[model samples]
Target: MAFTNEQIAVLEGAIASGILTVRYADRTVTYQSLKEMRITLRQMRGEMAAQVPGRPRARRTIRLYQSGSGNV
Candidate 1:
């Protein structure tokens, strides 16, 4: 699906406000700020839900890890 300019702007703003983080190189990198990753993900999920019919929607939650966290 294509996002409009306005929608993109809103997403960008959310990212800037610390609502989402795009990860790369095994490190968390915020699109706008450290805390915005969650917010952006929420917004994106909402947008996706609205555009896609008959799909299950899920709520957003935070998962925290201490230093030296490892994947199973």
Candidate 2:
């Protein structure tokens, strides 16, 4: 499911407030713990970025180069 900025804001607020129970627009969710909430928040942010645009995509790259020693 796509997440809205409002939802993210709500979750962030709960985390900042150090509360586990988050009351969203029309729903109230009780997290198992602060750690879980944090994890969810991260996921939410990632998902939001993926859903929206202007977010930089992560890329993994590797370059190999060899240099001659003593003109060998």
Candidate 3:
């Protein structure tokens, strides 16, 4: 479904205000992160790229090192 200009304005407003929440057709969407918001915006604008499945999500790796390792 295509979004109207008013809806676009609301989305833009939410982005600008850093709210990241939108109410659409009696449904509320609280974006998890900026990435999710952008994806939703793209979809609302009829962009197919964001609609594709298997889109790799950003991943962060952390190193866990033990000092003076002991079998405990």
Candidate 4:
């Protein structure tokens, strides 16, 4: 997710010339400038990562039924 200074400069040029755009399945986004694009990309990446499945829940120690009885 990190970009070198040279790469950033190149992207900045492309953005200034309207060559770079953010595209999703349903729509496209045009950034005002490279700085905005970088910010937007970072936010999008965070959102995508957050949507990924997380670790399973830990097992519970307490049981509802004990010694075949209905109540604890």
Candidate 5:
């Protein structure tokens, strides 16, 4: 699920307090580990970046260049 900035803040707070449980309004989430929480935070940040206005999303690119010599 995509998390909002508020949700991300809550997660960060929990991590800062060394807590595994995060509360958001009426819902509460208990994470399995710090690794899980960190992963969630990273994902949330990435999502936030993707939602920025006029920002370019990651794209695939290809470039053709000459190698050493034509001999193989």
Candidate 6:
């Protein structure tokens, strides 16, 4: 499931507070300590960040001018 900004904030807070176990559906993930949780969170955040859509690039038009050339 995708996490909202608020939810991600809450998760970050919980990790800071040493609360590791996260439940989703019928599954649970428990980290050994805040350090482990931080590492996991960093990985998750990196993956999520990579998944975000970026702005489309603008198209460039190149104009070539010929000097004293009137060739059709």
Score each candidate by Cα lDDT.
0.57, 0.88, 0.72, 0.57, 0.92, 0.69
Among these predictions, the greatest lDDT belongs to 5
Ranking by TM-score: 5, 2, 6, 3, 4, 1
lDDT of 4 by residue, 1-72 (tens): 433444445545556676767444455656676678778556555554555688444456965654665676
Tens digit per residue, CA lDDT, model 5, 3-64? 78899898999999999999998998899999999998999999999889999998989999
Q: Is candidate 2 or candidate 5 better by TM-score?
A: 5
The most accurate candidate by TM-score is: 5
Clashes of 3: 0
Over 4 Å off, model 2: 54-56, 60-72
Q: Which regions of candidate 4 deviate over 4 angstroms?
A: 1-28, 55-72
What are the per-model C-alpha RMSD values against the true structure?
13.8, 5.6, 7.4, 13.0, 4.1, 11.7
TM-score of 6: 0.53
Residues 1-72 of candidate 2: C-alpha lDDT, one tens digit per residue:
778899999999988999889988788999999999999989998888787677778788999888777474
With a 3 Å backbone cut-off (N, CA, C), the pairs that clash in candidate 1 are: 18-35, 18-36, 19-36, 19-37, 19-38, 19-39, 19-40, 20-36, 20-37, 21-37
Determine which window of 10 residues in candidate 4 has minimal summed lDDT: 1-10
Error of 1 at 57 (Å): 11
lDDT tens digits, residues 1-72, model 3? 546666767787888888978886688888898788877776676533335578755468999888785777
Poorest stretch of ten by lDDT in candidate 5? 1-10
Give the per-residue lDDT digits (tens) of candidate 1, residues 1-72: 543445555556655664564443354544655445556556656776677888766768999878764675
**Residue 49, model 4: Cα distance from true site in angstroms:** 0.4
Between candidates 1 and 6, the one scoring higher on TM-score is: 6
**What does the lDDT read for residue 8 in candidate 1?**
53
Which residue pairs clash within candidate 5? none
Could you estimate the TM-score for every candidate? 0.31, 0.72, 0.51, 0.40, 0.73, 0.53
Worst 10 residues of 6 by lDDT: 1-10
- Expressed as tens digits, the lDDT of each residue in 1-72 for candidate 6 is 454565456568777676788765566767688887777677667656766789344468999988886876
Ranked by lDDT, top first: 5, 2, 3, 6, 1, 4
